[model samples]
Target: MAADGLDEIDYGILHLLQQNARSTTPVDMAEQLPVTDTTIRNRIDRLEEEGVIEGYVPIVNYEKAGFPIRLQFSCTAPTKKRHQVAGQALELPHVVKVDEMLSARENVQVLAVAKTTEEVNEITAGLDDLPLTIERESLLREERRRPFGHFGQHVVDD
Candidate 1:
């Protein structure tokens, strides 16, 4: 509703959608958020147009889907080849997410899931072969991840 940034209603709509994007409709959000359905629809369209709402994705249980090993890799590359190396990592098997970091030491963060440690090693080996990759530090994820939420905690209702 504001020219510069999101307001209370916008944040509330986002919160409800984040909780359950697939089932949450504008009508349902309007009932819970004290806004009209038309308002909700407008806000959502604005959010999408502004790229705030990128896209929706289904949450998968990787462990139950036969991929239990979760690995995190922090990698660094030369400034010239940083983007090239990161793009190459995305094409590797089991690579789920690849993020570019601002830090000087490690500029790339990769999240991968595999069915076994062997698969993790294979993925790492493929990454290591890339040119300009200076260093890589990996860790196995142990804790169970909770569902995505908590974004609304910082939003104040008007």
Candidate 2:
């Protein structure tokens, strides 16, 4: 394991889980990795205890689910209020993710889904009510999407 407690095997397990969290069992992982089922289970348990593997979630295709419009908003707020503003954004409906950015121009990023332009405007209006200045807004046009693979690759290389 590295100084932070996660080693190459741990990363590989994480990657396999990320690719298919619901059905990828430790036994299945052991077949592909150089570890036994008991080792896989032990590593996963340790990783969970260390909070490296927070939780499992299903990846949803919002566009296919009728939420076609993807709105991205970048807001600027004081460093002290960044977390507060991000929290407020998280409470907004349809918000998928809210992050605090460290850059000067933009300090908060909000990603939300909407079914129509009016819904997008409504979401924007709500964000405007927060104690932050909206710096930029864009409608995302996703051209490609895939599962995360870098973590597994890094582990193998290490």
Candidate 3:
């Protein structure tokens, strides 16, 4: 095993997959790492089976997909009911993401997308009905993500 119980090949696979899962194939990873395509395939399967890879999902452009209004809701949930409140918030139709924070003041954060201000108002109303207190709500301009750098570059035999 490599650092953090994952082998170097695993890290390489994770790095490449994070960079571009759609374009990065086992063969591509093999050419970069000191392993065969079969090895890469098997490793990916194992990683998924072990619940590390989780799931492969497309990063959709909500605005382009007819949801131009993006909003973030910051809320304070009762400490003991944070998880429950988050789950309830996530169940709301426009809600796309819910995060439970460590801070008690603003513990629940919800990301929602809508096609119109009416829909945005509806989402806000739904959240307000929940067991949490809405602290702040703001429009989301954009979001960017990238592979974790600690996953590192391609592994080479030293």
Tens digits of per-residue lDDT for model 1, 33-136: 77788998998999999999999888777778898887888788776777888898888888888887766668888888998778978987888887635365
RMSD of each: 3.1, 2.6, 2.0
Best by lDDT: 3
- Kindly report which residue pairs in candidate 3 clash with one another: none
lDDT of 2 by residue, 1-158 (tens): 67876778888898888777899899888887788989999989888888988988777789999999998888898888888888988999889989888876698999899998899889988998889899899998883656677666554322
Against the correct fold, how does model 3 do in TM-score?
A: 0.93
Ranking by TM-score: 3, 2, 1
- Give the C-alpha miss distance for residue 129 in model 1, angstroms: 2.3
Better of 1 and 2 by lDDT: 2
Off by over 4 Å in 3: 154-158
Query: How would you encode candidate 3's per-residue C-alpha lDDT over 1-158 as one tens digit per residue?
Result: 85567888898888888888999788887778888999999999999999999999999999999999999999999999999999999999999999999887899999999998899889999998999999999999999887687774746322
Q: Among these predicted structures, which one has the highest TM-score?
A: 3
**Residue 38, candidate 1: alpha-carbon lDDT:** 97
Model 2 lowest lDDT segment of ten: 149-158
The candidate, 2 or 3, that scores higher on TM-score is 3
Better of 2 and 3 by lDDT: 3
Compute each candidate's TM-score over C-alphas: 0.80, 0.87, 0.93
